[model samples]
Every structure is written in C-alpha cells, then in structure tokens.
Target: MGVPATVSSTSSTLPWNVHRLPRADGSVFLVTGGNAGIGYFVAEQLSATGATVVLGSRNPAKAENATASIRARIAGARVRTVRLDLADLSSLQSVVESLEVECLDAVVHNAGVALDDPPRSETPDGYELMFGTNHLGHFALTWWLMPLLSAAPAARVVTVGSFAAKSERLDLDDLQSRKGYQPKRTYGRSKLAQMHFGIELDRRLRAVGSTVASVVVHPGGALDSLTPSRPPIHVPTTGARLSAAPAALLVQGKHAGAWPAVRAVLDPAVLGGQLWGPRVFGLRGEPRREPVWNHLADTSVAARLWDASCDLTGVDPGAIPG
Candidate 1:
C-alpha cells in the first residue's frame, strides 16, 4: 500500500529514536559521503548499533580519519573505509569491484553538492556537476550495487533528499541547465530527481517482486552552524559561516537532521515508495512518513527521469530485474 495521503497524529517524538533503534550487529552498510555532515552522524549512530559500516569518501585520507574518529568514539566499532567519488563513474566502478562483502544490508546515498551562487561545473563525464553527482552518480551506484543488496534477506537503498527540493520544480527539458544555469535551481532539481528515482525504484522493485527496498529521506535544513565542527569534514568557510549565522536560529543540528535518513535505513515498518522527513514544518522535529511532492507521484516523470539517468550514466537499470 502507498503511504496515506494525510497523517492523523501530531506526535513530537521520533518513531526511530536512536535509543529505540534495533541493533544491527551482523549487517553491513555502505554510506556515501559518510566522512562528514549528516552522513558522518549516520555512520556513527549505525556503528553504535553494532553494524559494520563502510565509509565512502573521495579522499582516502579523509575516510581513514573519519573511520578513526568513529573507532575512537565507539570502542570496538566495526568500521571500514572505501574511496568513492560520486562525480566519477570510473571511481564508482572500481569501488564496486573492490568490495569483498557477500551481502550489503543497506546503502545510504547521502553525498551531494549544495550552494547558493556558484559557478556552473560539470562532472568528469561532462554532465552538469550538481545533477550528475547528486542524482546520476547515485543512480549508477545503486544500479551497480543492487545485486549485493538483493542477496541480503532484506536490504534497503536509502537516498538522502533535500528540503530545497520543495522550493523548485524540475525542468525535465533542461536537466543539465544547458540554456542557463542557476546554482540553487540545479541543486534543487538534482534532489528532486533523487527523490523521484527513489519512488520509481520502489515501484520497479515491487514490480519484480524483489526483496530490496528503496526509501527516500531528507535532513531538514541541516546547516553548518547547527552542525558540529569536525575538522576537514564540517569546516566552515567565511561565506558558509556568514550564511549559517542567520540560519542557525532556524536550522536543526546536522545530527538531528540525519535522523530521518537513519530511520529510513533501519525502520522495519518503512515500506518502499514512502518519503520520510521531519514532522514539524518539514524542517525540524521528528522523523515521519511524509507525503512526497505531487510531481514525484507522476509515474511518467519518474520513468523519463530514470531513463535519462541511465542514458547519462551508461548504467542500465534494466540490467537489474524490475
């Protein structure tokens, strides 16, 4: 069944509070951008629950340090490091090949690019960098790793979306912003694509009778000022600090923002096709199964976006059943 169109309750407490989350001792999870930000907190909390976590970072040194920090905080925490750059397909392929695990319990597609006004950039593949890295990269990674996730008794693919998606509509005709590009618009579109992909992927998995589940969640306005300082990972720049100073009053801590995604990963009741996020004003409060944007429900758009992602990345979703 699809998520209810409206929620009846007004509970302030989270359904997937860290203290109440189930232990995951034997499972393995791979988290992209796990080295810092909300991703870092997600990795830490997962490891705290006894799950074996593989932290994905574009920089080997950063991954190593992040792993070390986790181990330091949680004695006997099982953590490993893998170099992953979402903007580069070759890097993703290499990481997929190097994996030795028999089953991947969950994958947190958390890495993405976000900025206010920035020069337009492109990925190594010559696609718009924001859309390419935030959406297509994750699309390809999930496609390549689906087999491993399927091997597990019950596995999940958690795609981290953004509150920014609500502010902008997707322009399917100009996904790359070829005509003209605005940084925030492109970023919002990228997140919208990710959310759309998650919903569509859920439909596909169900169609094939696949056990693997796909869920989308967002950290509500998680800002640098609200997020804890972690060197090299959560470092604040002058511009970032200036922007965050005002936002600090409105934004939730990165850790609090991460709860929705973490809950999406571990909550057994979570069904595919549900969009999860904070319950209070969709920004900060508690994790809940929120309704997705109306446009995201348009299956036609989902199918086209999925096809476009596959075409751009050259990672065929058809290769996986459903």
Candidate 2:
C-alpha cells in the first residue's frame, strides 16, 4: 500500500506509513513482540494516531529503541517499553508486575515464532515451540491483562493469524504436537487456536456484559517477523513485494502487512466478533471484513481450542481478571 491520502510531507520520509484517523486519544495498548517486524509497525501506527503504547518484547532495550524511533518521528508519541518473553511464564509475570497500574485498551497478540526446520522443540512451559510461543504464551498474556482491558469503555483484543491457517485445523488430540509435529502444521495450529480464542473471548466477554471486543484476523504472510527468534529464511527468500501480490509472491514488509490488523483494532464499524484479512489474493491490500474460516472458526473447534488453551496456559477463562 502507498502513503495514505492524508499523509504529512514527512510521512514519505518513513519506511512505512499508515493512515489511522487518530480518535484513539486516550486508549492504551500493549503489543507483544513489538520491538520488530509487524508488531513494531502496529505500535508505531497506533501511537501516531494518539494512543498510548506499551511495547512488549523479550528485550526491553529493543523495545526502547523502537519506541524512541517512533517518538523521533512523531514528537511526544506516548510509548514505553516492558520486557516479556512469551515462552517463559516468569517473564510474562515480570511484565505484569511492571505494569501494576497501567490500563489497557487493546492487546495486539503479534508475537509469534516460525521455525520450519526438521525438529520439534518445546518451550520452557513444555509445549511445542511454535504452539507455545505463537499461541499459549499469548493466551497467558491476554488473561494476565484482562483487568486493564475491561476498564476501558470499549476495548479490543486482536489476534494476528496467517493464511497458512487455511491448511491446519485445530488439533486437540495433538495440541502440543505430542504425537507428530510438522512446522507448517504447528504454525497453522497455533494460528487456528488464536482464531478460536478471539471468537470465544468475544462471546465470553459479551456473556458477562463486558465492553471488550475480541477480533480474529489473518494478515496473510509476506511479513518476515524480524527478531532474533525468527531467522531470515522464514521470510520467503524470493518473491514479489506486497503481500497483496499474487499468491505466488510472498514478499512484503512487516509494517505494510500490519494494516488489516490495525483496522480490526481501530475501525468502529467493525463488529465485535468480526473476522478480517486482506482482500487481495496474497492478502496484501486494503482490508475487508472476512467470513468465518472453516474448521478454524468452527464454533465447536473454537470452544475446544479455548478450553485447551486454558488447560495449557493454566488460565481459567472464567477466572480471567476484570
């Protein structure tokens, strides 16, 4: 996507620019893995639009750097940094402890690891690495931040999913990939789990009369998560730029790729349970609300995925802080 119609002269100076009509004046957001890639762009764009941003990363220094860069571009952009390692519950707890009094308007679950090598690995929490970091840790983080989220007049929780999700359905029997673990299956399964959590979270929040909206989204690849955890090859070495490119070309900046998700977070017309992604073949272009994805968005599967997530994360959805 090119610069927004309302872009400033300096907007062209940036590597990535987005147009979010900044009514986000008083909102607070906590974004996971925000130091780099899609997460960074999400935080920067939201902050430029007047939201206070709490950038979460495994490295607080990197988080600070990303935030500082945003401030340099958009003077006084309210942003801060906190250390969080999704794979480690201890690190997750530390972030919660650090934010003892901060409020949250949204939690952009963008932190994910994509390792497509031959072997299967487990997190410190003992789940498959892909599932553990991509889904479980985020599940734990969302539950950990429920109170801050519920306080807002209307808050949202955006789960960043992927097109690879089309291939993998929720695997309750092998949620941790105990029986078998293919990297693609592992990543897709994690994203599928996230989709369920988003829908289920919306249902549960409404059941309790809460004002929060949980929205699921498939950003549709083209973005290479630029962190130490995810290496270069995972970005799809050769291809057309713009995830919106043909299904064949899988090249796009993490920043340009974060559009659909930002829309899900800030678009007031968007329904609470609405799902969205890219309209183009490869999922890079103006965002459009999407219909429910089969199997992954299946209510039965979503319910099961929700329960399994709670079981693995040790977080009781019924007991989430509010």
Per-model C-alpha RMSD? 4.9, 6.5
Report the C-alpha lDDT of model 1 over 1-322, residue by residue, as the tens digit: 2221111122123455655566677788899998888888889888887788998889788788788888988999999988889989867877776667988888999988876776788898898998989998999998888888888877888999988887777788999988788898888999999999988998888888877888999888776676766665666676767776777556687878878877777777687888998877888767888887787898998888888887888886435762
Candidate 2, residues 1-322: lDDT per residue as tens digits? 1122222335333333246343466677788888888888788778877777888888766777787777877888988888888998646766777765556677889988988785889988788898889888888888777777766666788988888887777767888887766787888878777777778788887777776778887666554532112221123334323333454344355666777778766666556777888767646665777887766557787777777787777785535534
State each model's CA lDDT, in order. Answer: 0.81, 0.72
How far residue 221's Cα lies from its native spot in candidate 1, in Å, is 0.6
Write down the lDDT that model 2 would get: 0.72
List where candidate 2 sits over 4 angstroms from the true fold. 1-20, 100-102, 224-251, 318-322
Colliding residue pairs in candidate 2:
244-284
Q: Model 1 lDDT vs. the true structure?
A: 0.81
Model 2, position 161, has a per-residue lDDT of: 82
How far out, in Å, is residue 218 in model 2? 2.1
